[model samples]
Target: MPQAQKGICAEPNLHALYLMFNVHEDHDEEVRRILAQILNIFDHYDDEHYEAMVSGVIAIGSNYWMELYPGFLPAELAPFPDMHCEDRHAPVVPCDLFIQMRADRADICHAMGTAVYDALKPHVELVEQIKGFRFLDGRDLTGFVDGTENPKGMHKLDVAIIGDEDPEFAGGSYIHIQRYRHNLSKWNQLDVPHQEEIFGRTKTDDIEFASEMKKPFAHTKRTNLKDANGNSIEILRQSMPYGDMKEQGLFFVSCAKSPQPFTKMLESMIFGDAHGNYDKLMDYTTAETGAAFFAPSVDFLKFQGMS
Candidate 1:
């Protein structure tokens, strides 16, 4: 039997929960209080993490906030999707909150419901009422399966950088989040080979297409970074498969040395360049949300600038 070819890369535990909210400038203090109260409740009741294992940092200068999961959650509360066939596990069965100041109440409700899968856990009962929302599932739009192949072990080191990415950020990395919607009905219509072509790899992430047949024009090819000596630059991809059947998709998050790589990747995705033909997967998905945020090191939270 042929020895199995070693896979080149992997993914780490990637659990994500985000929201954009509305808060008047005058109410910043109150909003911070509400957020802090919620965080406290979760920190106390949440069996998975404590302050040490997790990093709860305030972003947007009390206007925005986020919490990082130090590890995975219990089996009862894990993120699941239909497409994954691997005997796998869930990562960071944690939650987060965001404020939507630009939109009205209805829009905020829809965004949370659609982006966070509130129905699956019943926001009122689990969060507001129970003080926390039990973890649930985040699936991409196509509904076949998602997040089955993630980087683990040294791969985490490869993709998630340390102090090198940002001087002030010694332990943390830059985080980027994008919400994408999938046209599953449309995607389902395409043949499997075509799907594979769009992804630039096998469904299992096991193989790339034959070099000649490979679509050299793709974000994968373009942003597949190389060092000064021409080695692949590594970045951690902790993106989670998110969305429901109707308004579902991915909560794409990546941490890297600099935003340039990701920006260049997106540019290639939007306007196909030489090697990046753009992600053919776009045929079935739409980019609906985009934002860039800095995830500073724990020590750098209080510091401003150069971080």
Candidate 2:
């Protein structure tokens, strides 16, 4: 079958759209019903200060499994057959939203986050309290602009998912969440060049190291996956800066396939493969929470028990 094309709205200004859903045999219909209801709610409540911040939900489940991705993966191992299983049913972890605000507009993000939370409280099985923040400009925990090297346009499709990673769900992928705590004091002490080396890019988003001089085994490069035939995997990243002034950093939401892209990416960061070396950014960022989950295709919900 030829790959189908759908119209995605022009990108919104939202910095992050975090989500997590528990799967079940009966929950398929419930997801559909909930999604429809939420869409209506957003339309009903749409406004300048508060509008539907969703970028559409991709239901990737099939007749056998309601393939919803959690924010993190469990520590216990699963057998190959039970790999995509959804054990917990209720309290479907709530989806989160992060909107952009002016540098000093923490109050606005907070107001919007709270408004969203209140609106969905009654309908959702559970609505996790929303969190929002102002952008820190170009600097990361290490005092440098992060994601300066992010892929854009057609290239993003390749960087996200394009490989043997999962032929069954071509064009579809998984998302992972990791809450990292930064030792800012330590990160602040590093000189500019040292900071740049850790990120494997120039301090500014522009200009990358010549191929030979790049960190061969860097997280920026290794987390990048290609298919069995060497096609790059393409996945969307909607992570955002979330937290208070004293304890702030990324909410780290990465979507990909079977957790391989993310897992392998982290592995490369911790223990670099043959050519590259472990990630230097680790000296500053400390991962505190990790979870993995699947985001099912919209059609999957229709088959499941959705009304």
Best by lDDT: 2
Query: What would you estimate as the lDDT of candidate 1?
Result: 0.40
Cα lDDT tens digits, model 1, 180-249, are: 6667778889887777667655654436555566676533454464557976655555454555435656
Evaluate all candidate structures by whole-model CA lDDT and list the values in order.
0.40, 0.44
Off by over 4 Å in 2: 1-32, 42-141, 154-172, 216-234, 274-276, 302-305
TM agreement with the true structure for every prediction = 0.57, 0.63
TM-score between candidate 2 and the true structure: 0.63
Residue 78 accuracy (lDDT) in model 2: 21
RMSD of each: 13.4, 8.0
Tens-digit per-residue lDDT, 1-307, candidate 2: 1121111111323343333333343444444455434433333333443443433333222211323323322222121111111221111122322121221234444543344445434433332222433255634545555455456776655554423444434444455555676777787787877766666667655356665676664445555656689865544554556666688667665554355555555655666666445566665666655554444333432333243
Best by TM-score: 2
Question: After TM-score superposition, what is the CA distance of residue 131 in candidate 2 from its true location, in Å?
Answer: 2.8
Kindly state the number of residue pairs that clash in model 2: 33
